[model samples]
Target: MFASPAYAQAAGAAGSSSGSTIFMLGQFVLIGVIFYFLLIRPQQKRAKEHRATIDAVKKNDVIVTAGGIVAKVVKVDETEVEVEIAPNVKIKIVKATIADVRTAGAGKPAND
Candidate 1:
């Protein structure tokens, strides 16, 4: 009788172990889904929008560079832009460095 009890307990432990493994795998899958929706998806969307903005940059547009410099786009080349940060102060920056492009008269003061 004692030997039979030992066998029954062993069988029950095997079933419970498999059930716990399934539950653990399910928890991992759920966490991965949550991360994709909450973190990865939104980041990809923003990157796409930023790329569109960078591509649409043109002359005379107000742009903010990645280095935090705000200037006017003097010329838009195939891979670079010449920005005039001040009176007669121009610099050629890579197209990818253009962080944001503001429209004409968008950032100027009303009284000016």
Candidate 2:
């Protein structure tokens, strides 16, 4: 039964248990920061820009819905918009569902 003192000395030189825990926590924090920048921030920015685009909708602006329906805006309300997908046929849609707004251009064709 030989228990060498060098075994205890080797264990002491390996690493601190608390330091490994702190390093693991630092890794988690770093992952969170990367996710915030890579996923969360860009999505919020796109939402903000889309909101701005929706709010700026006006009569005669061409807009495409999230459902891929391209229509010309007939009337703009606070929360709803009137869009004509076809001649003499208009439908009301929520403002948030509007995906893109094309500004009024010179002699742009109507949805009719």
Candidate 3:
């Protein structure tokens, strides 16, 4: 009973537009999944590793701070670290603020 050409044209147009919309939505979801797997997941994993590194800190380790300060660990606690940025110059910072640990044997004065 397809007598009205105008009605058929309108139905076709609506169907095509709906299909395009669904295709766009699927594309967006795929992109989001790819981003999570390729970008967000790796970043989160790296953050977890960095946190573990900070938690395992011990004295005499060489560490770089988030503020770009390089210091040697004088003391390490559950929540904080005392770093000797220079001889006889110790500063306390949060353990989470440490960016990197250079080595385990670092900061130990010779002959100790």
Per-prediction TM-score:
0.82, 0.81, 0.78
Q: For candidate 1, lDDT tens digit of each residue in 16-79? A: 9978999999999999999999999999999999999999988788888888888888898989
Q: Rate residue 42 of model 3 by lDDT.
A: 100
RMSD (CA, Å), candidate 3 to true, equals: 5.3
Per-prediction tally of clashes = 0, 0, 0
- Residue 25 in candidate 2, Cα distance off native in Å: 0.6
Show the colliding residue pairs in model 3: none
Segments of candidate 2 deviating more than 4 angstroms: 1-15, 106-111
Report residue 37 deviation for candidate 1 (angstroms): 0.4
Q: Which ten residues in a row have the lowest lDDT in candidate 1?
A: 103-112
The whole-model lDDT of each prediction reads 0.86, 0.87, 0.84
- Please provide, for model 3 over 1-112, each residue's C-alpha lDDT reduced to its tens digit, 9 standing for 90 to 100: 6679888898888869978999999999999999999999999999999888888888778888899888888888889999888788888999878889878655443323
Which regions of candidate 3 fall more than 4 Å away from where they truly are?
A: 1-11, 106-112
TM-score of 2: 0.81
- Tell me how far the alpha carbon of residue 98 in candidate 2 is from the true structure, in angstroms, after superposition: 0.7
The C-alpha local distance difference test score for the whole of candidate 3 amounts to: 0.84
User: Higher TM-score: candidate 1 or 2?
Assistant: 1
| TM-score of candidate 1 versus the correct structure, residues matched by position | 0.82
